[model samples]
Target chain A: MISFLQIDLPALLVGTLAALVCALIGNFLMLTRQSMLGDAMGHVVLPGIVIAFMIAASTATWVMLTGAFAAALFASLLVEFLRRSAGVEPSAALGAVFTAMFALGVLLLEQSGVARTSFDVHHILFGNIETAIWPAATGLSSLFDANALANLPPQVARLGFGLFIVALIVILLFKELRVVSFDPVFARTIGISPRLIGAIVVALAALAAVVSLSATGVILLVAMMVCPPATARMLTDDLKTQVLLSLAFALASGLLGYAIAVLLPLGLGYEISLGAAGTIAVVAGVFQLIAMIAGPKRGSPRNA
Target chain B: MTEFREILAVLLLQAGYNTTVVMLGAAALGAATGTVGVFAMLRRRALVADAVAHATLPGVALGFITAVALGFSGKSLPFLLAGSALTAVLSALCIQWIVTHTRLNEDTAIASVLATFFALGVVLLTVIQTLKTGGQAGLDVYLLGATAGMLRSEAITLAAFSFIAAAVVAAFFKELTLVSFDTEYARAHGFPVRVLDLLVLALVLAVIVIGLRVVGLVLIVALLIIPPAAARFWTNHASRMTIVSAIIGAASAYGGAALSAVRPDTPTGPVIVLLAFAILLVSVCFGSARGLVIRALGTQKLPRRVS
Candidate 1:
């Protein structure tokens, strides 16, 4: 029905954009072998947002974003500190710092009664995009069935545009991200400070989290940041190929999920909450499975 | 003053119940994790636990949705637990398959799994919340948990499960140790290393499920790692480590529950993890083999050669 098409188009658009952005971030995470670090940093953002709200006297979107960004950066720095000084393994150090910080955040939220607020922990974990509208598209029909030209909601369109520009910038500066991801030691020898690159990546990652959290919620943001690139890596080793494959994977999953959610009645009951993020993950997983089994065989054993 | 004593009396009485339930639950969970943590850590799959924990979130969400759809009371702890366990096990299996079939490193495979599954879970959780029409925010409670409301049934189930898990560990102790330290040696000896590995993983999954009610998914991994890690400081033998780890785990559970009871409304799992970490720090400083203070004082007081 025309009505159904109208309803599903926005879901597809937002989901697709979210997945695309996640895949872009995921590529770099995969290359660095810091995939779980995304989850750690994401949870670490909880306290950041809570602190921001506490100080700002409001949960205004920008204020929360700034807080989440600072917290994420702090978590990244904390991990680095633990790794260098405490001699903790990177994953273990991440575990220590983030979990501790999150516990503190939870305690603070409980004390402040933020857990009961509208923009509370629950909403932040699983986002509510139902009321999320594209501000620029007021009184506009962004969907046309004849040519099947489905336009995105205005704000979503802008976000996608911004995301595309960011992706483009990263691509133009691909050398920077690649050098930093591939060999920090070598990059440092050749005048690139891995530390600086790491800081930039962390900053950009936090920025991505801030953007995605509005849609996906804080908990699921890491999925977008880690899944696509990881799946792409299963099929290819080259960084460029991985990024390309990740983007493709993200797009396919987002579109497919949106289509499925449209077709199914469960959308009415449960909202298919994961939307694009879930779809991207599932698709990436499926792609990995296919690549693992059907791809060309290698003679080398696994733990070798 | 009388009102204060009455409140104190009620809390102390509740503390007795909380301590017994939580310690038994933590010990059971700790024993299973200690048994499995050894192999995963030995295999250099330490981060795999993180991945598995992250991946399980979707399963928990899915389980909750399924329970709701089936018209079951949302508070059906067993159903929720079952749903989470099923998804977690499936995720683990998927990870194993990916590792075997793909050229991706263990770390990469685990990371990818962690991300995708967790993302899916987050998205679903968001969707669920958005769609909710009323006051029942069932999913939210599972995030950090409110152990103050833990029922008798939940405690009993954890204890029973823990005992069975411990029994399994005891029966297979020799085989697990042999296989874990040297899978190649086990393979040469025709010890079915793959089967043993699967058994150990199953035990780990069981521990995770049992702990879900108490610690929830996010922090349960901490309990698994910290207790055994602390116990490691005290003992070199695997069996002893498992026993001591369970003791440390149980002590923290009891201690945390008791403290929370006394202090009214403190989070139990974090407190327990803190307690475990405290034990670890203490053992690290004063335990026989690796105690820093003893080593430092030993170095200072050593009978060095006169020359």
Candidate 2:
């Protein structure tokens, strides 16, 4: 049982947690018609991690997370600036920022000789979940698990918990989020500050993304976040129902993808290449395909 | 002085090789993508190029794997490109079918095809890597290319194919333009719009497949988009735009290669993209016909009206 817990639970827990976090934030992105923004932010986070490592000389999660958030915010601000001031297309602005920032991060990494330790950064873009180890004991114990099972490595639990908090907050303010997502002008007319709501959603999405980077890696996270919700949109008209279905789809994919990845060596003659996060993304994509064919007669009304 | 002269001679010789390979390859790919991309852009299918580009990854990997399976003497660049081209064209058609047959909008169809195909590519690539198959580790480099790998043969093939492809475009330029800008007009005019559309798409995928040796798949969309976008800034006529776009594409290829040669670690794709962007900036700001500066300066200041 202990061996089973060690072998099965870790992968299962991490995959499900990643899917939950991605779904929580993904709904907002899909609603805003900014699904690709996750991909842009994923790349933009690189310069932040690089800069943080330069200054901090440590990979402590909090420092890196803050650095990533700041950089992501700056990039988002720059994208908005380009859109407003320069009249550059939004996608063009996104492409420019991510490419330039990715280049800058590479430059910094090479210059600092941190490339040796930091080369895993590229792998971090796609992720390597199998090698990830459980966190050390934090000395905080849950009454339900006196053996401290609840205190399992933060990596296994943090993403799901973070997502739960985000989902709760979103639930509490569901009306505002929906109004702002669909029609900011009308939302503002109703006394909801659309801009504030939009900013909060973008920030939360970014925070969720930063946490996701620890698991899914950067390159693949956008797919994980966007695909499930986008697929969900195809199956339903109700915005609320879409979110619920997307969560179900995402979590189911995580579990199935993890199981197949684990069973690859035994069932197939060869070992599979993808880790849990990638497998989950692949599974989500499969779900989207099935939904496309078997889905309802119409895609949902525009998120607005 | 003697040492300086010898070194200069060697550098100049190498630079010439770099210039020819880069320019020719970019021009061929640029013209092909431009021709196809015009249709894509006019159809408002800009993102499809991105999707197709991503879609090519697994095809390239599979082609490589097949080449290995056959125990080929060489990497079989042409075969690899052909496979990718086939995959890409099929994927593009699948996207079209999904949009038409299913209730899915263009965005969802495109997103689904793009993500699913790319995820498959990533999964296959990882599996191959884990197998320790004797191949390059950064096969993804084919997705994000560095032009330092270009050789003499690739350049010649690109140049020759581009010239032929350009001639085809020139001969059919009027028909292609007619179809791209207004499919309804082309259809009414008795043009074979569907055939022409497929031809243009075929050419574009061909170029993308071949060009992967240099700029790779990810930034290939930039090649397809930026040159035409920049060229559009200079002219409204499709014929002139195609010509100018080809020139810009080749010139950027040259410029990027030259700069990358001097800047040791610089990847050619980003530099080329930057060059294209720079051209766009210039065209946007200073082009004689429709540049921002001229438009802003020429027009009388009017009271701004908010929507």
Candidate 2: residue B198 lDDT (0-100): 76
lDDT of 2 by residue, A58-170 (tens): 77668778888889888888677646644555555565556556546655665577767754444554565665443433323332464556555556656765677788888
Interface RMSD after interface superposition, each candidate: 4.0, 3.5
Residues A28-69, candidate 1, lDDT per residue (tens digit)? Answer: 766676666666666778788788888997755577778987
The TM-score leader among the candidates is 2
Per-residue alpha-carbon lDDT of candidate 2 for residues B1-307, written as tens digits (9 for 90 to 100):
7645643543344556665566556556656655555555555445766678778877887777777778862256776776687778878987887777665556556656766677676676777777655654546557656556566776778667767766777788788888888889899989998898777766666667766766666566767666665666677788787878777776666666555556545556666666666776687677666667766865645434321
